[model samples]
Every structure is written in structure tokens, then in C-alpha cells.
Target: MLKAIIMLILGLSVLAAGFITLKRELSIEAFSISSADEAKSEMKNIFNDQRWFYLSGIALFMQFVFQGFHLTFEYFFYAFLISSGIQSLFYLFNKKELDYKVCGVIIVSFLVIYL
Candidate 1:
């Protein structure tokens, strides 16, 4: 129960950070990755086209329901959420590019988180 609660809090925090990173692009933060401020094609593409996150979230929730919120599942999911959030921040800081460096960070972070 305690582990699950911790995982929920961490996952939600990371997910919120990811959302904020994406949202920052839409604002006039001077680090905008949109093709044009007037048109905002990139922002639209990110907001409208990202469906995997929704699917993953639903899948995890379903698994939580089915497994009765197993601790192992929550631990892994929390790690994944944090990794994704860190990657989003990395991409946001690096001109919205998901490069090898971000991938490396994901890999390293997961290994550290799991092991």
C-alpha cells in the first residue's frame, strides 16, 4: 500500500512535469520549437498526434485494476514515468530533439531505477 502510494505520487509528478515541458513550447518562452509562432504547426502536431501516452496510461490503469495495484507493477511503472518525464525535459532543453543522448539517459536511468 505504501509503495503503491509512493509510485502514484512519483508517476503523477513526473507526468505533470512532462506536460509542463510540452506546454512551455506553446508559450513565448524564447525556446519555442514550433515552426512558426503565428502558425504553431509543431505544437499542434505534438498535442494532436501523441496517442501512445494515452494508450499506455489506460493500459497501466487497467493493469493496476486487474493486478490489484501490485507493488512490482507500480515500481516499474513509476520508474518508466520518471524516465519519460526526464526525457521530456531533456528534449525540451535540447530544442525538442529526441537524440541518442536522451535515449542513453533513459537507458541508464531505468537500469539504475530497476537495479
Candidate 2:
């Protein structure tokens, strides 16, 4: 019972985060649209901001929903691992460091496969 409740809360929280991030992105999009030519000039920065965070939040929500509510600690751990891996991969890729990207991708891929 406790486990299910916790899972529900976490799932909702992740879901909320996804929505919030999406809202922020929409607001930014609106800004860009209203700013005329200036927005297009800085298109790169606007689009890239916080996109990964929103994606990972959605991934986290999916992890719980797909795994189903359970009492086992492994589910919780795996959910976190997958969510974290997604976020980390986003970070590494964004950093544009080849060595870190290679290692991070390998680790994330292995964890994702386990899912």
C-alpha cells in the first residue's frame, strides 16, 4: 500500500514536471514569435533550453507507468536509474565532449537495455 502510494506520488510529480517544462517552453516559443526578427536570430539558444529536462521528466513518468505499481525496491531503483541516465546523456551530449559522450552513452544504453 505504501509502495503504491509512493509510486503514485512520484509518477504524478514527474508528470507535473513534464507539464511545467512544456509550459515554460511554450511561453518561450510565444516570446520568440512575438519578438519578430530578433527571435529567429537567436533561434539556437531558445530551442535547446530545458528540452532535455522535459524529455527526462516524461521518461520518468513512463518508467513508473510501464513498470506498474509494485512493492519491490528494484523497480524504484531502475526507474531512477533510467530517468537519471536519460538526463545525464542529455547533459553529456549537450556538452559536446566526445570522451564523456562515448562513456555516458555506453552506460545509458546498457541500462536502457535492461529495461
Each prediction's TM-score versus the true structure? 0.34, 0.32
Q: Which stretches of candidate 1 lie over 4 Å from their true place?
A: 1-72
How does each model score on lDDT? 0.51, 0.50
State each candidate's clash count: 0, 0
lDDT at 28, model 2: 77
Model 1 error, position 23 (Å): 7.9
Error of 2 at 54 (Å): 18
Q: Give the 10-residue window scoring lowest on summed lDDT in candidate 2.
A: 104-113
Tens-digit lDDT track for model 2 on 1-115? Answer: 5445444544555566566667867887443256757667678666774644544445445445555644356644545644554444444335545455345434443444343
In terms of TM-score, the best-performing candidate is 1
The deviation in Å at residue 74 for candidate 2 is: 6.4
| Best model number under lDDT | 1
lDDT for position 82 in model 2: 45
Q: Give the clashing residue pairs of candidate 1, or none.
A: none
